[model samples]
Target chain A: MDFFIQQIIQGIAMGSLYGLIAIGYVLIYNAWGVLNFAQGDMVMIGAFAILVTHIFWGLPIIPAFVVAIIICAIVGYFVELTSFRPLINSSNTRRLIATIGVGIFLRNLVRVIFGADPYPFPSIFGNTPVKIGELTIIPQNIWNTVIGFVLVFLLTVFLNNTRLGKSMRATAQDREAARLMGINVKQSMSLTFIIASVLGGFAGMLISPVYFVIPTLGTSLGNKGFSSALLGGITSNPGSMIGGITLGILEATSTNFSTSIQASVAYIVLFIVLIFLPNGLLGKKESRKV
Target chain B: MTLFNKVYKATRIWILLAVALTLPYWVPNNYYLQIFCLGMIFAILTLSLNILSGMTGLFSVGFIAFFGIGAYTSAILTTKLGFPVPLAMFLAGVLSSILSLTLSLPTMRLKGMYFAVATLAFGEIMYQLFLNWTAVTEGTKGIKGIPALELFGTSFRSYSKFYYVILVILILIIMLARNLISSRTGRAMLSIRENDIAAEAVGVNVPQYKMISFLISTFFAGIAGALYAHMVRYVSPESFVNAESAAVLAMMVVGGIGSIPGAIVGGIGLTVLPEFMRFLGNIRMVLYGASIVLIVIFAPRGLGGLIERIDNILSGKQSLGVQKKQQHIEGEE
Candidate 1:
């Protein structure tokens, strides 16, 4: 029973990380209808930024985290300007491919700069286990979950209450309509990318201590994040959060039974969900007007 | 329409074929020959992918999964089961086609991005299976020392000999693809690409045609993989990573999404481009990513389309129908 509780707690922590990453995916996807395949790479870049500032340059943890988020946000802006903006009128496949190209570029660039070695990340939260009855939870895990939920709450409030967020939503709903309504559609798109990148960077910084910082870290995690987003509802923030948590719990439970299939669990779940429910768990059924 | 034009068109194919047939002789250096051989192998894979993605308009990013399956099947068959090379290669294609059928049947209902994601998941799943099923795949250690391809008691132990074998196979595959593209089934595929609803309205069995296109494409990919396995005499999970699939997709995009000649040119150009970029070392991948982004943004029509346009302009034969066809292709995207 203790082991089960521990696994669930671990799952929630990991799922929160996934949720944070998935929110990034949701933001970009909701705005531009382009799945940013580089979302995971953004996370990797964030972790590396923290590594440079805190570990290498000897900055404090909080300052390093803020710098990392800013760095990633800048990268997100550039990604939109260079890759997304130019191909605005292009096909979805082309846009997706461009993002993929950016991912490859970012990953290779990191490898060239940092070399191909994994680095141990300095944990922001000290390595202490908090015990509740027979259950033991790592401080990092608690921090991860708390931060994840808080961000989700803040984002939800922003989207529902803020003018910029409403404008972004308007653009997502209908670009032409939003443009006619005097909304800066392009600016909204850029803002969405920036926001997504910051979230991705935050998720990276939060999880780095557990997964370590590696060049190719984002490839699989990004895919899983993508899966989580798709599973919840690509366009729904709450859906993605729920989806990530569900997947994390399932993954944890599955790991208990067999370790060999751990690598493929997310993909397998994605395949099953896509086959059975193409719109995802929380996605609305879209009607096509021929 | 003119006699001179007719004669020029008729002779052009022969001229191209002669040059291709005698390429190995002209480039007798084993190192360059090896590069050309690798290019031809990729050409087969790209061409096959073009059948589904370019011609049929099913953009699958997981074709590498089929390639990997084919390579592994042939390797396991020949090395473990002691089967003949030819038999193993043939069975490899068959098995890959079967796998493609199973995967596509369930997921073909998905449109566009959903379909791509499903296929990507399938590819990742297959890769995991390859990595984790250590008892069969030997885990990360990879399977090595597979025997070379043998035909008529003549082993293609040398790169030059292997070059001819791959060349012959490529030629046959090209001919098959060309024939199919010009056939009624090809028209059906084009219609599906343009609009599957319209195709269905016209009594085309959309799902069935998609299945057939997918099957044919995977069959060719499997053959390319088998050839690759025998040519390299090794099999490993590393060679079939998702990045490989992306690379192949990059080839198709740069070549010209819907153009056959484009696929050939793109595959060969990309295959050889990396070798030339060796001086750049790790920067090559960065450049590769930049090139893909730049190409997609600037020349969405691709290198092949650009060449075709230039040719039409230079020959003073820019026809309205050709322009209309190009527009239609772009519109389908």
Candidate 2:
């Protein structure tokens, strides 16, 4: 029973990380009806930014984190201006391909700079064991779980209460309408990318200690996060978070069967969800404009 | 058309065919020939994807799944069951198309990003099977030492011989693609691409055309996969990774989506470009990445589109119906 509890805790931690990445997908997806394929690379870039700032420059963890977010914000802005802006008037397929191109560029650029080897990320939270009754838990796992949920909560609050968030939401709902309403539609789109990129960077940094900071890390992690978003109502904020948590728990339980099952759990779940709940668990039915 | 124009068209086609046939004679080394073979294989992939995505507007992100299916099918058939290469290759295509039927049925209802994600899930599931199904796949060790192409006691052991085989297959695929694209079914598929709702209103069966495009695309991809397996004498999950699908999509896009010649040029150019810039080493991919962005931005229609523009100028025609339709696709919000 303790083992299962412990596994659930770990799963929640990992799932929360997936939640962060999924939120990033949802944000950009809401802004423009396109998935930012490069969002995963943003996570990788964020982790590397911290690696360079904290490890190489010898800065404290907090400062390093802040610097990484800032760097990612800049990256987000630049990516939008360069890859997406020029193709704004084109089809969604072209925009999607452009993001893919950016992803490949960023991933390979990291490979060129960092080499193809995995790098160990120093633990942000100390490796202390916490005991709750008969259960022993890693401090980082607890921190990850707590911080992840908090971020999700904070993001929800921000979206509901803040003017910027409302404006961003308005833009997502209808760009033409938002523009007509005198909202800075372009600014809102750029901010959406920025926020989404920051979330990706946060997820990357969060997972770096657990998983190796490797160039190829983005693809698998990104795929899982994308699945999480899909599993949760893709357009809903809390829905995706719940989806991420469910996926994490599912993964944790499946690990008991075999590694193969665990490895494919996300994809299997994705297939099932797509077939049964095309609008997703919490997503509203999409209305098409003829 | 004038007699002079007809003669010019025939001569131009014959000259291009002659060049393709006599490639080995003009090429410098076997290494270059090997590159050409790989280029042709990818061209088939690009063309197949182009049919589904460029023409049908399906936009699959997990196309390599079908390719891997075809490859594993051929590998298992030939090595384990003692099947002949030609028969195994044909069966590979048949098997992949059959498998696609299962997927296409469920996924046909999905549109845009939803469909892309479903295909991605399909790919990941396929990849997992390739890796975890150790009883047959050898669990990442991959299938190896497959027999080379042999037909009627004539062994195609040499690269040049293999080149001819691939060339013949490629030419047939191209011809078939040309015919299909110009057919009534092809026109129906194009109508769906332009506007599915509109196409449906016009009495075209959107779902049926989408399925036809998907099946045909998977069939060709499977055939290409079988060709790749025999050419390299190996099959591995690594070759069919999502990045490979992206690369092939890149080729199709760079070549000119929905254009047969575009798919061929994109496949061959992208494949050969990296090899030609061997000195750039790690930076080659970075440059490749930049080029995709640049090309899409500057030359939105891709290199194939550029060729059409040049051809129009030389022929003194403003633009053809095909080009006009392409503009409509781009111009549609």
Candidate 3:
């Protein structure tokens, strides 16, 4: 029972990290109707940014995290400006491929700058497992869950109450309609990218202590995060959260049975979900008027 | 005028055949010959992918899975079962087509990014299977010492010999693609790409046409894979990954999605460009990514469109406005 409970905690912690990244996917999809294939790389860049600030520059942990996220947001802005913006009127295939190009470029650029070696990320939470009634938990895991929930709550609030956030929602529903309503659709899209990038950075910083900072870290995680978004319905924020956590739990539990195929479990699940539940767990059926 | 056009077309084909046949003479050495061979192999693969993505408007990032299946099937057959190289190659293609048909049954319903992701998953699953199925795949140490192609008692062991073999295969495949694109089935595929609902309303069996397009593409991909395995005399999981699939997709896009001549140009250009850019070391990938983004932004029609534009200019035919109108209609659709 204790072992199962421990697995659940671990799964939740991991799920929260995935949820953070999935939020990025959801945010971008909602705002621009474009899936950013480079979202994972954005997360990777964020972790590297924190690593450089905290470790190399000897900055305080909290400030470094903040700075790192800001840098990621800037990167996201440029990504939209340079690649996504120019190809806004192009086909989805072209847009998707361009994002992939940006991903490839960013990943290779990091590889050139930092080399391929994995760097040990400095743990913001002190290195000690807290014990509670036969349940031993890492402090960082608790922090991860807390941070994830906090961000989700804040994002929900912002989207619901904030003017910029409302504009973003409007843009997502219909770009032409949003423009006619006197909303700055372009500005809202850029803001969405910035916010999504920041969330991706936060996820990276949160998970780096557990997974180590590596140039290739984003590839698999990005894939899994996308799967989570799909699992929850790409358009729903809360659904993404549930999807990420569920996938994380599934991954954790499956590892107990077979370690060899663990890497493929998420993808297999994604394939099944895509085929059987295209609308996802919480997604509405989208109708096309042809 | 009709007679002149016919004669000109015939003359061009003859000249192309002559050039292809005598390529080895002007080629400097084995290194360049091997590059040409690699380029031709990629050309075949890109063309196969084009049949689905370019013509049928299905986006698949997992054609490498079919390529890998072909490579492994041929490698195991020739090396383990002692089958002749030619028989193994044919069986490999057949198997790949069958597998693709099976995959299409479940995945053909998906559109756009959903389809891309599903295919991507399929490729990853195949890669993992190749890596973990140690007994058959030998588990990443890779299958080695596979024999090269032998025909009429002459072994194609040298680069020049392999070059001719690949060139002949490429020519045949190109002809096959050209013929298919002009056929009834080809028209159905183009219709599906233009609008699946409209095609279905017009009495086209959408699913069957999709399956056929996928089957044919995978068949050719399998042939290319088998050729690759035999030429390299090895098979490994590392060579057939998402990166490889992406590279092939890049080639297809760079060449011009549905154009056969574009596939050839894109395949050869991308394959050879990397070799030439080897001097830039790690930065080459950055350049590669940048170029892809730039190409998509500025010239989404790719090199094939450029070629058409040049042809129009040479003939003093100003049909640019008409072409733009056609593109606008397609885009609106």
Candidate 4:
């Protein structure tokens, strides 16, 4: 029982990191109606950006985090303008292939620049274990949970209340209608990409300390984020979060209990989720609009 | 579907087969010969995967099931039963395809992406079993000392000999694939990809089309797997993982999904490109990732589309580009 509790906590931490990355995927799909295969890698780029800024550039965590995310966001904005916007206007297959190409390029570039070796990044939260009865949780885990929830909460507040966020929502709901309403639809779409990228950037900073920072990090997490995006069913933001953490639990449990193959739990969970509930737990059923 | 069309197809295949059979002598290096052989192996797998994903649009993230099954079946048969190489491999391909087909039939009723998910799930389960079932597969260590293909009195040795055998297999497989895709069966698949319900409503027999796609894809997949087992003389579960499957799918897409020639180009281009990227050293993956993003964003049509565009320009014809009218006219189907 205690072990299960610990596993769940561990799962939540991992799930939150995934949820953070998944947010970028969900955000892209919500606005663009396309899966950004490169989102996880973008998160990877974000996390690496943080590591380079802090460890390599010798900047402190607070400022590095901000700068790294901003940099990542700019990179994402460029990716959107160059790749996605064109695809959004082009054929469906064109967009799919393009996103996949972007994902491949990004992952390979990381390998080229950083080497394939996993880099160690210091934890943003100090190395301390929090004790609660028989269960001991890593402070990083708690921080991840707190910050992830907080980030989404803040995002919700922003999307609901702020002018820019409202513009994004309107654009997401209906591009033509939003454009008719005098909202700059194209700019809003770009901003959505920027916001998602910024969120991914923050996620990378948050999780870098715990997970080994590597170029392949995005490849693994991208698959996980797909599950998260689907989990919230394609339309729900909070559901994406739930999907992330829940999948994390499934992964943690599978790792802890299932036989060898520490890495494939996500694939199994992904297949299971996809096979059983293609609609996802919270996702609205779109089904290619029949 | 015409007699003349059939004759033309056969002639073209024979020419390609003859080329594959005779081409290896031009290559000078033994190591390059080996790489050539491996390239053929990947091409076979890519062709197999193309039947499913490229033609039918049944996108699966896990195809390693048949690949691994072929390896395990061959390994178990040869190592335990002391079976002849030909018998073991033949049985491996057949059995692997059967296993893949049997598992796919019921689940295939679920259309589109759902089929992709189910196949992926099944693949994961098979990988887990291979890893966990230590008694047979030796767990993570995988099956080793797989006997080389011995036909008649001679053992397949030197990269050239192996290359010929693999090329023959790839040619035959490609022939089968070209035939299958160009036939009525192929039309049904493209229809399904375009719209599943519409195809069914138009009397396309959606279930049969899906099953046939899965069967043909896995048949080639099984052959490729057996080829890999024999070629590498070793098998590990990792070789058949989802990532490998994804890579194969990526090849199909990058090469030109649904285009047979595209699969070959994509697989070879990607595999060969990565080997060269080693010079970039540590920065290679970063470059690899960034470029994939850019490529997908820019070239949605993949390599096949690129070729078509170039062809149009070279032929002095103004291409319609993405306009639907020109696509239907240009597409062989």
Please tell me which predicted candidate would have the highest DockQ against the true structure: 1
Candidate 1 lDDT, tens digit per residue, A23-83? 9999898888888989999999988988898899898988987888889889889888999
Q: Write the per-residue lDDT of candidate 4 for residues A148-237, one digit (tens) a residue.
A: 999999999999999999999999999999999999998999999998888877777787887799987776677677667666565788
Provide the clashing-pair count of each candidate structure. 0, 0, 0, 44
DockQ for all models, in order? 0.70, 0.68, 0.64, 0.43
Q: Which regions of candidate 3 deviate over 4 angstroms? A: B1-10, B316-333
lDDT of 2 by residue, B69-102 (tens): 9989999999999999999999999999999987
TM-score for all predictions? 0.96, 0.96, 0.96, 0.88
lDDT of 4 by residue, B4-39 (tens): 445654576577567667777777777666776777
Q: Comparing to the true complex, what docking class would candidate 3 get?
A: medium
Which residue pairs collide in model 2, if any? none
Please give the range of 10 consecutive residues that has the lowest summed lDDT in model 2 chain B: B324-333
* Full ranking by DockQ: 1, 2, 3, 4
Candidate 1 regions with alpha-carbon error over 4 angstroms: B1-10, B313-328, B331-333
Residues A1-290 of candidate 3 have per-residue lDDT tens digits of: 89988999999999988988998998887776677889999999989999998999998988987788788989999998999899888777777778888888999999999998999986789988999999999999899999999999999999999998899888989999999999998899899989999999889988889898998889888988988998998889999999999999988888889887888888898889889888788888877544
